[model samples]
Target: MIIIKQYVSIFEPMKKIVVLLIFLAPVLSAQNYTIGNWYDFKKGAISLTFDDGHPSHYNTAIPEMNTRGLVGTFYVNFLWNNSWAIEANDVGHEIANHTKSHDSLSYLSVGELHDEVTAFNQKLENDLGFPIRTFCYPYGNGGESDSVMFYIQDTVAQTHLAARSIAKATDDEHYKYDFALSERDYYQIRTVHMRDSMRSYHEDFRKVISTGGYMTYMFHTIGTPGGWDNMEVDHFTDVLDDLLLIKDTVWIATFRDAICYHRERKTANLTTVYAPFENGNNWVLNLTDSLRDDWFNHPLSIKLEKPTEVVTILSAKQGGIELEYTIVNDSIVFNAIPDNGHIIFDILNCEIPIVDLTVLDETIICTPDSVRLEVNYDSAYSYSWFKDSVKLEADSNVFFAKDSGNYFSEVKLNGCPINTASVGVSISGVCGVPNANFESDVTRQFKDEVITFTSSSTNLQGTETYYWDFGEGSSIEPGYYGPGPMEVSYSTPGEKDVKLTVTGSVSFTDTIKNKIVEIDDFNSCGIYKEDFNGPDFKFWHWCTCKYGYNYTMEFVNKALRLNLTDSIYGEWDNFKLFFYEDSVMKPFDFSDDLYKPVLRVRAKASDTCRASFSLLDTNWVSTAGMKMNQIGYIDLTTKYQEFELDFSNLFFYEWENKVVDSTAVWGIS
Candidate 1:
């Protein structure tokens, strides 16, 4: 007793066409004997067929099909090292003949055509013990000339059940050939050449079901090189995943199986004997046909209106051999071969299998993590999983979920479907709340040097706003949102407090304050440059006047102006401006060079006056004999003129160590 229950049964109206394409052995069945147009009585049929002996057929295409438990037909060449075809055949995939060398039949002579076509079929049959049943034209070029077409067709018809040709690689409605079983010609069958578009495949699949016609997809290579047209593996997998949704509506079979079933169904005959058993319905159906059972042995799907009071199929058998059957609401479906003997179905009001689904993992998942969902394992039924009212590709009882949606399972017990309650799974972080943060490339730089600041905030929902403030005196004003890495520089030297604020969706706001960035007055090469038009001067200090003499240094008209007055000291009144930070000149790297550090000052005296500026030692005393360190007393005039006081022609090598105690002299008398 060989029984396998792989029929499809989803909850739908009786008018909704349902079918299954499992490659199970033929089973026996119910009272009504209306033969399905396609296998399992599907609305339409589809066959994914590939050409050539490309390695990708074995490496990529075969594994993907096997993962879905779907099958395809591969037309291979005998001339190439085509050993993978045997393995494909062992796994129930069709391996037919392309040709010996795939030479175009139009260009070949009659003798050459026979050799090209028959030799491949003969060789494959000898190796596999089963005659090769289908053929494919290389590049879909069957024959351009009439004579060539006639010879190729006559030769192909002898061994092949069908030969598939091409009908452009597009979704033009004209190519949608009516595959209504009896309406199609076995030879010269038109096919759609598959390209790298998942949308096109989807459209084609939907059209096949709507028109109730057969659709064949022709491919050369998948996710590999060295083929005329190559499709991305992702596109191919996406098409397959989508096809799984309607696996119950459309019959996905090999070219040979579809041809055999349709040809046999055309002339099939059935005799039904309906009799009432003990408080239930009983059926004994005899399915037979005129075609040779040896050649047309493919099982045809039988659908009947299920009896209402019959809750269980008590027994189903063929010629005293027990068989399997499925009970869809109002429709009992199962597979049976013609001339397979008497198929008996006994319906009873017995208890049926009960199914329950459970979630095996957490209901709340992180953004990247997934949860596992499963149904109770039952060998008596098959399963179909769904999410948010859409069918999923998972057919097994278990499924791993990464996306957030309501998930449930449809358990089918011998064609009777029961849907479980939906379990909701939610992702934790979706809105992406704003978290404000930033980083600068440099902590301290020269006044004119630019610093780059980049925002490193999280939870950005694409509409987040960014605000950056690079402290006062910066080159840019604090305004609305700006993008990073923001280049900012300050004209005034000080410790700058940088701030970054981000406002995300739903009025979520966050702000972060970065550490202080110090801007220095001197350049990298230890050169001091300053303009005293400032709110603050970090390098200069105003010392107390000597012995009650008053000296004032103030910003008058944006310039540092000095005023001296004395009541006691009279003409001896003097004041000196010293360098800040304990008289240490900052950035003092004037060594190993002939740099004679010149002081350029723009000034004008109120009267004819004398003044001297010098570099003082650590004790605040001027270097008297240090020519390179002193600017001698020079006469000043009323008119403001730029004065360049060049130091004596001497390289100050010792000044490299003067960062410890160096000071500046700015005394006026």
Candidate 2:
């Protein structure tokens, strides 16, 4: 509120007052509403919403909406992953909650309802930083009783501002924007189901437009045709085309925006005061509303008519914040979430124009099948086509678009340039890639085998992006947006679900499937560690010293167990198991010459055991080789654990005549 104390002197000139009016005239969007007239007094509003968090909804529906410069709401669920919904939220679309488990709420108690409704709201808010106001009913099955429905709204989903349910029957032909609301009417709002045939949706939309009502649409699975509520991308785009045509007349908003605007306008008041000050006139715009701050804080759009020839505004400010405004014909339109506070501004000196652009997207991929250019339907405006900045000879309404070039249409109204919308037409890239398809060369390969994958999909147009996952824990070309076969290998033996995900820019669709494939692990050599599967130590040797102690070694159940029983402890109470420890019997040397550690031997004992795995090799410091011993200690009285001894930690030693240690070579333990 601006309070002015004026003391105008009789000597003040009229020229000074006229100059003062010129200063304050430019900053005004000078129009006020007779309260509760929403969106230039449009008949109704419409919001495009999608559910189930499908991949195509983000990759397909969002890009299609962005082409028309419209945003939507996604009732996000953990269909694939939370990250996908978070990505859609980051793209400036509303992300709403749809519960953790998409289950029927037929017999859920109050506590279970919280788990389904309130808890889901908190989950989405925590993950995406998106406040959950709108929710979609899981399967829309709360039709049991009116009292139960009221219980859900008043108690269970009390946190949500409103909830949407599937009302295909009631909303198909008899849909209306209910201006009147009970306590639970908003929470139990119904939405028209959108599927393959959008004729019903379009009809209801027209009905809403003709009758001054609202049409709320719900869709799922954009490219997956014939699936549950399958709305194909092309069929969906057909509706978006007509919506863009009527974008100016209709208020295309998210459900939250529409509901908030309805509540805010019912109590909003815009007041302007004009009075004489000491030297100039004071024009202050005071905005006040009765909505609470917690629930209703969204900005309301204000359309202000240009008061004078000072129409070209340089700046407009309120509460010290520079307001976002636009020029449409002779009006300076801006927005403000009112708070009974006064805003002060002055006329800005800048030129602006009013362009009624109806084109959704200019860039078109030229196909042998079809293409068309948007000519101005209004004969009042002159339209001309251009290719690469060169004017075409054709000035007709229907210009068939062909060839590849940067094309644009210049629209002139009343002999003045209004818009110059351009379209970049290209003859490259795929057009209709609805599903991702791929194949691998072989299902099962050895550990060292390199598996190959290739694409075999229909409706592939131009350039493509490819992702390949070899299910044995190897991935190739991640986040790669192109076409190529992927090759990778696995180390262990297991079955694999090799998946390939490919998405095309022309049509955003993905194929996520597991191609049957298997892999084999590395074949083990019985030198250091093995499940013993041969004759028991035949080629080997064992020595047992008798001092009231005896030892017996045998292969039992694919395992090697050396049992010992000692009645008395003596100096010779020892047993050594060796692999032919003689001069001619040299230990096995790894052919790859690769240094490997961790000797694993599964063993069980009858008594407390102490044994040493001795290796006599020539790779030691001496030419004749030194004896390197790795100790194994276990007392597996009931159970056995695999003993893993790392040979890399062995001490390096060389001997001269088995006496003095010389220069240390590579240790063999």
Candidate 3:
């Protein structure tokens, strides 16, 4: 009885296998198991995966992926052995959640579900310093609900990453079904497990290898697992060896890659041909559905009128395959590949030419400046511009209009209409009037330097009123004027706030203010530190006696002196010195040194603000052992409300400084 029971247990699985094979025989013979026609073709293409996060993978996969040579997503779960899996340096492999417990995700609650996937991703990012975009449900049992899948699709669409499920080719078809859930309408990809002894397995794999289609296999544990149906390591290696032997002929690729390639290669064509009306010589062949394959063996055919010369069928799929033929007067003969699969062909003869016309301007926002209209057409001999269908006498590519309205154009060839396009023009008043205000240094011993304010408008057609609010509680500037240039002036020591409100037939306001700080005493301020350090190197210094509370010092390089001065009160805007050189500044703006100096100052009585300097060095330069300058600062606010500064010789001195280098200089204050 015991022996019989064991035999029965073993026989049951065999029976199931036999049944499955019987069902697959007809389908396989018919070659109807193609990706798209019978199944979502994308799902049939390939599987993407990653192996154990071994050190070698980090050194190899990361750099290779960064170069776009390969892309393989990794499943990291083991905490001890796979700790390096989330290393900060790995670049290419997509670190995915493999669950904390490695338990079946289908059984977890929503919260637990979130923790398992989300937490793992967060942890990976926190540890690796790179985001994990793709995920593989732990244990191949991430039973995400349809609603959840929809949410994922929508969210992933907005992100640079996506999540996928693991499926087996032998799994029940229903479980593997790819359907439209939420906004995502794609099938879950299936993965093939590779284990030990792949070498021998290839012997059996040959039967399904050469179908001009995809043959995917899965393996787990190269050698047999202690339990269940597992193959030996030798067998797994054998399978891999066999695949390598035929690798030249087979496209072994990740599932995602395969699907993308197939989608791009699937050929379909739609054409409109023009034939002579009198002789019916112009034939229009519409090959809209010409190469749809539901299965590998599906046959496709195309029909055309018998002709004397071979007619070439040009299509996205043809790759320029020309058909040279003997065309008998009224018909053309051509042959299509028998394995082209299910296809739809439409052959028609027409007398008129097909033209597609489109307008270049979809949306136009009119400013006070001129508006340009462009017309595009498939095949037109000459184009005529028109306003309300009335032809306009304009030959230039652009039409200048002072007003706004609807405009259209027509293209004609040999007195025949070719195409027409139209555009709507909307004209509005200038956006707003420019605000003019003045600023000056009030505390200076000399006459206060006053800056004048000027305002202007684009188009002078409308009446306009201007209102200004000076910072010293002064009355608003009251006046009205037409569009053009305007100016204002100020002669006070304090910071001023100016607001300009413009009111016209159409109302809009433009506000401008002089963010100027007047320095009455230069003796009271003292700068303790200054430095510069980026692609280029330069430095500046101010004598302790020349330091004043409200005074400004200019770093005099080539010609441009970077002005270091106090900003608005209550704002942490202190003077910042830049180190990088502006190579182009001299040619255009006329500045001194290409590099700007760095600046450092105290924030308050006790605390100090420290700013680090950086240079934007190219990877090649850095790899060549280039270094950057280091600047130091000393806060003297406690004793004299000043700071001390020093510069280090860390900047790259070997690279010759070129005025045309055109690098940028920026400072953090």
The candidate that wins on TM-score is 2
TM-score head-to-head 2 vs 3, winner: 2
TM-scores for all candidates: the values are: 0.44, 0.45, 0.30
Residue by residue across 23-104, what tens digits does model 1's lDDT show? Answer: 4544334446577788867888889999887788899999999999889999888633434676788888998889888888
User: Best to worst by lDDT, what's the order?
Assistant: 1, 2, 3
Top lDDT hit: 1
What are the RMSDs of all candidates, in order? Answer: 28.0, 24.0, 20.0
Cα RMSD, model 3: 20.0
Q: Model 3 over residues 1-669: C-alpha lDDT tens digits?
A: 111121121112111121112232232111111223212222222233553343434554344434433444555664443334544225333455555666666566667766666666677666655655445555555424455444333332222123455554443332232322322323244445554423434533443333334434543222335622255544534444455565544544543334333332343232333232322423333332222132111212233453223132222222234434333344433433332322222222312223343444423343565555655434534666777667789743455544566676555445444334466666544544433443332322111333344444333334555555444522325445322233333344445554445554434555443343332322222342223432433333322212313333344333222222332232222333333334222211212233333323332221333322232322114335533332343332322222323222223222444222222232323
Number of the candidate with higher lDDT, 2 or 3: 2
lDDT of each: 0.66, 0.58, 0.38
Ranking by TM-score: 2, 1, 3
lDDT (0-100) at residue 330 of candidate 2?
A: 74
The parts of candidate 3 lying over 4 Å away from their true place are: 1-48, 53-63, 78-253, 257-400, 405-408, 413-470, 473-496, 500-669
